[model samples]
Target: MVFISLLGLFLLSLTQAAAGSQLFDQSEVFALLGDDVTLPCRVPSIRSCSSVNWNMVEEFQSITEVVKAGAVTAPGGKALRLDLLKDCSLAITHLELHDARLYSCDIGTLNSSVSLQILEVTESSNPGVDTIELHCFLNTYRGYAPCNNKGIRIKWRSGDSKPINGDRFKVVNPSECFSKLIITKKLTDHHRKWKCQVTQDDTVKATTSYTTTIKGGIEEVFAAVGESVSLSCWATSSLGGKGGGKWAVGERTLTHDMSPHNGPFHVSEDSSLVISKVSALHAGDYTCSDSTDQQRGVNKVRLHTLDVTSEREPEGDNVTLACVLTCTKECGKDITLTWSGDSRNSWQSRSMKVNNLLTNSLFLPVLSMASDEYTCFVHRDSDVMASKKWHTANPLQTPAWVVLPLVLLICITGFYLYNKRKHPKDAEHEQSSVVMTPLYEVIQDVNNEDLQHQRQHKRGTTTTTDDFYDLLQAVN
Candidate 1:
């Protein structure tokens, strides 16, 4: 009997894993205003899925049939099964705000896949930043419940010192396991999610949550090399050090001293990251969290930094310069780009931007030879966004050209030193050959028998990279 029970438990575990292996694995699915999204559902047993049904986990946790066997089962519902045999996924078309709810797909197994849907707040275009709303949700042992429970406390305060309580923040319970807290006020704080925490046994634990977004905030910033940049995650200074915060980029988190940020970055007591000198490495997404949120694990932070880059190429006698700004859709508007350094007066110019791609490109053709240096400037209205400097150079006078000469010099010096080690007297004229015009090309034509002897002694039949260049050209 014990053996049979152990086998049943093992099988149940396998079924649970198999059920969660499909799609986002019950992760929250965020929808926009008008998204035709799919609340994917995959059954554990494909063979039993011919009659398997998709159901909405309603207010009382009751199952309302949605679709069955690749067909809609509910009347007036736009839900459809992706496939019966290959997939048990459900597709939701014309998604609405209320559609963000819990769902499950059962295929006659001990375990089934479940997911919760939520709508992401749309970015408001309203001026004055006067109107702001905070949407808060709650969850408890009894599933999602109201936010006004005796032991329940909604922690949705922002970095702004102003307290949000009473009628300003209204808590409404439309259904079980769901509560919406609506607040109307002028907010200058960064967009953040409401933290739903429950206090029990003199200890607090976080529960179900709803995210909020801020409008008309600067989400992207571009900085020039050597320029100072201040990235504010949230104005936590007003919290009176009652809480600490953490900053992170990708998987790496920040500590007391900056390691990955080699460009001299400092964290102010106010929880703002101040980069004194920006470099190419400083460009990427930055996220921060109030240390108080570590318990809740609600990571709500945003910042985009892109360092400027310049490219130049041969164009007859002059050079064609391309100044590119790598941006993203998160970058806000009021972008004004300018150019300088080439003219006696600072030159103002416009950059062509593509919406889908956050790329901004400004091209300057046939810049006069008299120009010593060139620079590109970006601004959001009067505030300087970023600046990149480009020094004017003649064709074949670029950094690549500089590197070519240095590499050739190193090769020649090594060859000359090898010759000097053995044939001390022959090294006399080697110095003169090094000073010859077009020195790199001159080494190829040099008929120095001593150098040739050294080459023969070191390696037989020199291997040249020039032939591989032609091979690459052929492939191109």
Candidate 2:
């Protein structure tokens, strides 16, 4: 039993050795026009192989006939030769567009023949630009067969001719069946009919091409001081694709922020910079660009500051103060209008319709009859352009009471002075006359006369008594 087992093991080893000797393995193939391409072929088996040969087979042709043989040519018109003992690989130099074909490595003995596909090779061209160096690339991740090797070669050709000799073009392999082409110092002459070709073992050649052209820069659409202006930039061709654009004043990027603005500053969807009030500060070169893709459409815009004349109603007037915003283009919703000074003092605002270049007015009612300094400020939102303060004349009317008090006091004082100056002597004379006409003997009486009259009357009334009274009176 042991002897039988030993014999069976020996036979199994022999069979494994035979299978290994006839085995072959290879890597993917890639090449450029007028460049050398190596076709990888390896023997992993332990058996001693008799010979190894490489064959080229065109896709459009049959591979049945055998032809010339030499160090440079094989029996079937193959473009490469291989040494069996030392090297089982094939080197094809000066490749061409038509050289894109399948190649196979065949190992043979006196009785057996085994073949392995070595890979196809092809040529490619690089893309060019006028004043820039553009690197051209071709990616081939989606190809037949799983390519474990990721290396390729690149070359450059002009107008269906052989490739030029230089290191201006390079090919690199980043992954299995993936490669890229890089070209240095691309010229305008090299922009025509550039192609990229990809090749791998057991797969067909793939080629892609691109055309080159010049790109343009950005331009200013509209720019004015103290006006709501729209700045626009567009690519020369509509086919250039869509990109993001921005408006800038000096180094600051202008955007739409609806917060309360002391001055005018705002923006719109079309990148219209609406400076609510245009001032000298707003007088700078404004730039607009599509920063996302620098594809030479409207890349940059220049804004020029212009002199804007602003006007408004004078102060203390029951007039409407209008802030006019001027612009070359139609004003959009980006513009904000506001009035400063007295109009703002009242905090009363009116929504003014945006006309071509003019705005509506802020009405001031019951204006005071005094010189009023009114200023109308115009802006987009934050950008103030011009502020105009004007003076209005008002009539002066004096009050009656202001002079009445002084006139009354003057009349009273004048009367008192006249009486003193003219009646002083007369007042003294009246006093003297009153003193002379006064009181001294206006009261003396005639008592004796009255007594004699009474005595006579009594004697007549009665004889005796009267005679007695009479005698007595006579004696007295």
Candidate 3:
């Protein structure tokens, strides 16, 4: 049914042309929407025209002549005029929906017919999505009209003028039926809408809108210490199969074998970042993107390095301990490295001038005391990001006098053991003889006292006997 309707429309147009006094067929003119177009009627002889009349028909309704003898008389004739010398044609400016009807020029026994144009605007944009071009297109039509199509007459606009074109816009090609308009300015803003209106016969036949949007992705990420995290990204399916992915922190490129980072971060084939261990160094802004296609697919995720570390020197007068604040990537600025401990009152910090320096650390000096604890905290302003602890050993000391007895005792024991081992029998004999000499002296003294006492008693008894004898003799 659709094919028959189109065929009937074609035949009816031909039959109507035969009604004119002349039978000249003129090709249809192509024009972009909101542009100017000229419909031509010519004679083979190129003679002066007695009179050329331009007439139009609406759908199937016949209309009066829009122009006659090179004079403008149409509703849109202000911008229209006739060029009637070798050829007599009607020109219309700023064509509209009303201009889409069949236009015919009538001459003495000679007539020419042409239909206005239609165009389909192709949408195009640059790689950055910055510049966009809307160009009109049309299929081939017989220079004269037997078939009519819609696409050519379109008006492009946004909140601006209809059929917009200016310094910010460039119209490389403009026609009553077909045109190409480029937006040269940068379109970085979001959710911008453009419109295209198709018109014919002074009425709007179709209106459409072309909208451009700025896509958004993940802006930041929070990764905890010791917890695995992935910086999410999306690579266009258009990427080549051989394409590889990488990550970036500041100026440093993250690699699978970044040994300095303990090989904790690696990027997948899809450009996603997976950190097996989130360390202080690994906490920072990371860009998950493919190395090949840099612009089309790119994203950044900030990793807050939450891990902390500490180191302490051996016990001494001024024990030095350190709290390290670092990450896989250089955290931009505004970081606070703090020191705190049980010996806080007596301890001294290295220097607070270490602010914003790439090397972030807090050195704490503690007086050598038993079990002194020190804590270091990292902060961005008042928010503490990480902290660590360190303990110092007590001072070790001993006096020479206190050690003398121990040294002498050890020497005596060593000398005796050496003599006994070398001459075991001689050492045992000397030890017994020295012990028995005191016992023998005690026995000799006891015998001498008994002998003295016996002698005294004997002398006394003799004296007594002598006395008795003397006394007896005297008595006789």
Which ten-residue region of model 3 has the weakest summed lDDT?
Answer: 139-148
TM per candidate comes to 0.32, 0.23, 0.29
Winning candidate number (lDDT): 3
* Tens digit per residue, CA lDDT, model 1, 111-169: 34443333232223342235454443332212243322233333433223123354345
List candidate 1 segments past 4 Å from native: 1-220, 233-243, 250-252, 256-266, 292-312, 328-333, 341-367, 393-476
By how many angstroms RMSD does model 2 differ from the true structure? 36.6
- CA lDDT, every model vs. true structure: 0.50, 0.43, 0.54
lDDT of 3 at 49: 57
> Candidate 2 or 3, higher lDDT?
3
Q: Write the per-residue lDDT of candidate 2 for residues 1-476, one digit (tens) a residue.
A: 11222233344335435756332343334344455565555544424333544444433333421122213344444434323333545555565554444444444421121212222222343344423333332322322334433344333333233343334445554444434444443222222344544444434354444444333332322334445655444423334333245556656766555311234665544544556655434444455555554554444444333332323356633555555555434444544555555545544446555434556465555453233565555543223434555454333334566678779877875774476468644432332212211231121112234445666776667668777788889999
Model 1 residue 176 lDDT score = 28
Q: How close is candidate 1 to the true structure, as a TM-score?
A: 0.32
Q: How many residue pairs clash in each candidate?
A: 3, 33, 32
Using lDDT, rank the candidates from best to worst: 3, 1, 2
By TM-score, who's the top model here?
A: 1
Q: How many Å off is the CA of 186 in candidate 2?
A: 17
